[model samples]
Target chain A: MKKLIFIFVLLIFSFSYAYQFYGIPYLQQVNDFSLINQDGKKIKFSDFKGKYLLVFFGYTYCPDVCPTSMLRISDVLDELGDYKKYVKVLFISVDPERDTPKALKKFISFYDKTGKYIVGLTGKPEDIKKVAKQFRAFYQKVPVKNKEVGYLVDHSAYIYLVDPKGIIRMIYRPDNDDPKRIAEDIKQIIKMFGTGE
Target chain B: MKKFIIFLLTGFIFLAYGNEIIIKDPWIRAVPPSSKNTALFMTIVNKSDKQDTLISVKTDIAKIVMIHKTVEENGIMKMKHVDSLSIPPHSEVKLKPGGLHIMIMGLKRPIKEGEEVKINLFFKNSGNIEILAPVLRR
Candidate 1:
């Protein structure tokens, strides 16, 4: 009886410490789409086949939340350092109309100092909308009264962690957005997939 | 140890103000030209024995600068403009990314890193505190 009780307590402890994914898993494959990179080169999602892709959707005009999220991810990548070779960062522009390929390049480079691991992607409006819908991301433009201020786009903030097979394994929310935690989660995913271990 | 260094730095930085009300490490987040709004963050320490209220903030580069708080609503983050913020006696209030912040709207120019911007902060009893905030990538 004591041995069984000990085993039960150990199981409960492990379950409590296990990481939970906030997104749907194994439900559907991420939609394939062609988007122009910062250099105007056309690329597809499957191009990132062997490495983990950290996909984030936001625009350059976003001031606070978007930059903070990007910075957090960049910090994670920075912490990974040499192990960063096993991962890639994808920044998708939801506001394609305003965020041109050239502007996206400059915007992403600002956050990523070395400009090595991050790829900024933008395409036509319909394509962006289609991809966002596939990922269950929401973005809407709201008009503001100020002329200089123009309008603001309210977008759903989520960092999707895609496995080596282009399957999203987990979703990160803004509430628990920490660089250390994200880096730890990525390491865990890489270990589970047995691709980068 | 970090907090202690920050406290010492805050003391040294605010020595010119006679330690009445101190602001430590105030910085503005740099934004692109297309962005209409940006945020400012800092640590406000009330060295006085009485509580104080931050009434308003003004910057010439921005047409409208207001105090805003970021609150989570049903898992979606939303920003609400606030009229004022209070700093208790001998306590520090941090204006950070996911919490209270100063919002700058209608930007005349892009907030670039390595540049310093001036802002005038109004307090109910402490009077006006003019601060020079450096633009940093947050």
Candidate 2:
């Protein structure tokens, strides 16, 4: 009985420690959504099963925040090294009007030219809105004064870490989180809960 | 007499080149092929006694060059066009990623890594200063 009580205490401690993640802990199943990938092929969220997804919402036209986040995500993938095969980065465009499949392909190629790891997704405005709602991501178009540059899109820059089972396990703010720490957390998650593979 | 003449030449050189606005670590973010846009970042140092304002930027590679600042509110990121950036005397202004940057749009061609982009920065006090910013990923 004493050994059983000691074992129970140890398990509780381990569970609590395991839950500590560098990003915000969010252990809820993600809602599935369909969108068009960079190749103009239809893709569903469930299709990424058995692999972790690093998802963020932005537009290709955004020269500042989007590229910064993309670079950070690339660094995170670099930090993963050999384990990057088990991880995938998803860049969902909120500006459907300008972010067509071809444009997305051009944008993502700067980060991942081979197109094996990083995937850019876009769809109709309504469909994009629906997916953004599912992930609680906010985005809106704001018209600018410049004629050559018609408008800009404002978006939330939270990077969601979805597990292999389509569950969002962590949230990272690129402004605050380091890529190395984010990669470490993903590795910890994979160790704690086997990569569903 | 030789020492005095050398001292005078050095003073003349300082008078001609010293106290000018200095640009450090100027670079353009390298984008993919067929990309229409990218951003430039650098640190503007003002050593003069008067404040200077960066009124406009011009580049031949892009159709439009605008000063833009990324503002974050309630976790939302928005890029706002800045008419001018003011650099105080004896201080430095950093235009970096996720903050103030020079937005270059409508690129004529892909700016690959290791390439240099010539840009002209017009300042209120310093007039136009030309620089060649290297294209880089960081």
Candidate 3:
């Protein structure tokens, strides 16, 4: 009877564990690259070694998805509370031609209320493309009808969660639009990776 | 007496046709001044037994407004312009983030939080209705 009860409990636990959440664990190791941050300073990927980085690739001109994702990341950071100290959000602009260091600084600062953990990065078009390719991301520029608006970019909307050791641990999909769930996932990753709360 | 009869007929017609669709929680996410495109969100409920199609949206704040659907194809998110959206009978259709939305392009002016923007939505069966969507900071 004791053995049967233990097996039943294990079965219940396994059933619950089979359920999946919003973010997907990719487990692909990330490579480091140097890019200019929002402060006009050249920062290397190694500079963020000990911190969990929430990386998102978007342009400054993107009004809906980019801003909404940034806001969601900010909300997750806020919900992390004291644990927020361990996390850093990076906004990498794919539109290198238009999104200069100054443009990125102004655009990223608008969404972040605290403005401490969030940082914007932009580099040369080639470098940006190379970095995006390393992460298996895609972006394309399409011309629009308006003369004033030259073009708009269609890109992947996945937000990547990088561990302290620079591994792409989890990815928040565009369809998974809940911020609170993302906070919970971050906490889970921190605990699993033994990265200090 | 003739005027009263005409008013009663109009009221009956409105009750039969116009009062079926209810617009709820309509709002636009506030964007920075430099950003050019923004999306509008709302929950539209069809209370009547018949279905309705949302044909188009118009706003003075923007030069063109298109109904768009965001789809994830091969892990890349892309927005496709849709002609009309169907709202089933006794059902609700939500225009939310990362889903269906009204895409406002060519912003004439920057929108601020708490500012009300007037929008006209034209439907195939229910005709046109005006909504004042408050600019909300998300």
Minimal lDDT window, size 10, model 2 chain B: B11-20
Give the 10-residue window scoring lowest on summed lDDT in candidate 2 chain A.
Answer: A4-13
Clashing residue pairs in candidate 1, if any? none
- For candidate 2, write residues A1-197 as lDDT tens digits: 67754664465357657566678777567778899999999999999999999999999888778888998898899899768889999999998898999999988988986689999999999999888888899988888776777888889999999989887877887586588989988888777778778
What C-alpha lDDT, on a 0 to 100 scale, does residue A175 get in candidate 1?
Answer: 67
Q: Give the TM-score comparing model 2 with the true structure, all chains together.
A: 0.89
Candidate 1 DockQ, CA atoms: 0.28
Candidate 3 CAPRI grade: acceptable
Cα lDDT of model 1 by residue, B17-99, tens digit: 44478999999987755566788899999987778899999999989787878766554556666879989888999999878
Candidates, ranked, TM-score:
2, 3, 1
Q: Top model by TM-score, which number?
A: 2
For model 3, residues A138-178, the per-residue Cα lDDT tens digits are: 99986766667677788998899888888786788877758
Each candidate's interface RMSD (Å, one decimal) is 2.4, 1.4, 1.6
lDDT of each: 0.79, 0.87, 0.83
- Identify the candidate with maximal DockQ: 2
Q: Candidate 2 vs. truth: CA RMSD?
A: 5.0
Candidate 3: give its CA RMSD in angstroms.
Answer: 6.3
